[model samples]
Target: MSHSVEVYAPQNWTVEQWNFVVWSEGAPSNTFGRSYATADWLLTQTAVRPLVGIVCGSGLGGLADLLKDQVAFNYRDIPNFPQSTVHGHAGRLVFGTLKGRPCVCMQGRFHLYEGYPIQKITLPMRIFKLMGVETVILTNAAGGLNQDYKVGDIMIIKDHLNMPGFAGNNPLAGPNDERFGVRFPCMSDAYDRELQQLAVDVGTELGYRDFLREGVYCVLGGPSFETIAECRMLHKLGADAVGMSTVHEVIVARHCGMRVFALSLITNQAVMDYDSEEKANHEEVLQTGKQRAEQLERLVSTMVTRIEYNNNYS
Candidate 1:
């Protein structure tokens, strides 16, 4: 007689339970192979070997449009890629040149709240590294937690508070893959200082200082906007801006020894006062992105050119 075994499905499970299942499976053995395959396919599609990989934040998909000689692939068409479900995210991978430097830009990004395993969410970073990307630039729209920040301000990410990681919910939570990185990775230098300085210099040169600020970012597992108390607590803890993405991608990129640069557009002020009537909404986020998209694009493209110059001739 044969015995029937019931498999526990993680589909309807809690986040904690789902994370346990993902951890148990470990990092997929085919990660590198799959990334290599994808990279090879992309190379065949375009002659550009990207040195820079960009992950655009909410409503910032337009950044990829600035690329010269662009070739784009939708997430669904790319092998082993996760689809983007959020509005304002276009779900495409674009390859081209930025200021004559080869680059790849993700028009959209996946999130933990979208029911994707953390590893899957960060798989693109590994693929980017395998595609010969040496540097990663991440941009996101965030809520301004610092009282001094105004909507539409660009906040350079000097540091970040990974609130999810504090609770053992991290992109690096699964079994370590030697091919990608060491078991224990250092995050202290995740965001490159030289790139941060370059961004500041570029913004200054563009006369964007009035709306450009630098501060600490906080990442939270989000599909819901923060409560006033939560906003107050994060602000008290020194978080100047708060968002749902970036930190995970940064962690993965750093693990693979890629240089990282990230910035947040403060789309709205966090509601810290219980009596305040203002509410946070995605429309506002997209609108703010539209308002600053041109300037932000100019800043990033200029930074890309400077990074290329520094690497080649400095």
Candidate 2:
């Protein structure tokens, strides 16, 4: 269905109408200026000049607790920030130090299924860019598509298949902002190879090699678990894990010239067989994330200490 022409005019809409567009569909007004304004607001609340940014996914909010001397803001307190309604999400932006390296963390993340437009959901990435973050580490709880992967495994994202991007719901779909990046940004190296290697090294040192795997993550618009056929197809199409968030934020972060590294905690195994009695649910996802939260934190925080020295974008 197509929207009426009047919907394009954000200025004339009521606060409720404008919000519905941004929070539900999308806004033509999600421009560079708006991102800059929000970044300016956040800059004042924290004394730290964070060079690293981390996004905590699902039940992984414990990662934020690792930060020392934190200054946090509720999403509702920030201009242009969307509130997170997901149960596992804490809906806060925190600025603090991680092992003495200045960093910022998102205790929660926005999602396509959370009534947010693609751009609105990825707004934090742009805010991260404007706040002077050079490297971004993202973690998510996902369903495992690779049969070799078990529940509680950690899959380092070497690449991803943006299922929503294929349908033209990409966060960077609208007007181009040259200040942030080129109109046609190359996604071929979206996940920084060096960072991927570093994560492996860290995980190995921490004796997490057994549960650590690497593969492409496929992101679908969710809130609904995939059918058996869909899971089979996605796995055959090269997805090791499947999820709803992270990919858009990765795209936005990369577009803004940040070095990116991401990983997924395989919360549940995707049921690819019709006869299987197993099921996928948020409770399972959150529970798995809770179980693996500590090791995930150790892996990321260890990488953060070495990121500045090893992070070469070239």
Candidate 3:
């Protein structure tokens, strides 16, 4: 006997119907179940049990190459994983050791502008927690919003303004899962303080004080760069960096009780003056990443070692 299975064709669905079927279901329990399934499959593929999870931002995917004894899986090969749509994103998960600490790195990350449901974008955070990862290091390429910031600088994320969340577009918008976190999670301490300080100390030790900074990052829904007016308003609102990713991932990681540390590589200066000839472009972002990639790698690797030492001693 033979059995046939039917799959729903999204192409035939109306726009409203599609939205309802995807986002309206919220963070379904099955999402958690599928994450476990994915995690199990990963375990079978590699002997590495990671304690740290890193998500590469924009052009920062080179960080993953520093890992030793690596095992990698393409997004297309991973069950239920979303493929990256942006250039400069390699769309792979790499498992290995960085400075003797077991880590899993997402060579690429998903974004809201990619048309993925918010829950889907953050699913990896929960999977990281389940895989026994206690710390998450997030990196991104951002436009400098502070007047004092210049292109090719690195900013440790101190806080964030979720511009999209203010309008009800939040990763945690779905029904709360007690298995993952409380119904109301605090954002007050979203970015780990000690890690921020550790990054500062690491950068200083690496002689990166001249360009190292710490400040608030504001997230805007983008595939589009901010307009001059928007850039000016963000600067006045106290943001030092602006980008399309990271904020949502941090929220999800914190919700699941993982320690979070994030940094932004200032790829370009946001145009706050209409008369200015400056424009924000992805090509410039990629170029800046290449320019500062080595230093950023050194700083993060040093921090990872320090974190491992601290965990062992304290």
* Prediction 2 TM-score vs. true: 0.90
How many times do residue backbones clash in model 3? Answer: 0
TM for every model, in the order presented, reads 0.89, 0.90, 0.90
Model 3: per-residue lDDT, tens digit, 1-314? 00100011223646455345434454365566556556657777888888889999888999999999999999999877888999989999999999899899999999999999998899888778767777899999999999899998999999999999999999888677776778788999999999999999999889999999999999999989999989889988989999999999999999888889999999999988878997789999999999999999899988888884225210
lDDT of 1 by residue, 179-298 (tens): 678889998888899999999999999999999999999999999999999999999999999999999999999998889999999999999988899999999999999999999999
* Candidate 3 lDDT trough over 10 residues, lowest sum: 1-10
Instruction: Name every residue pair that clashes in candidate 2.
Output: none
| Residue 86 in candidate 2, Cα distance off native in Å | 0.3
Q: lDDT values of the candidates?
A: 0.87, 0.87, 0.86
Give me the overall lDDT of model 1. 0.87
Query: What TM-score would you give candidate 3 relative to the actual structure?
Result: 0.90
| Residue 39 lDDT, candidate 2, scale 0-100 | 75
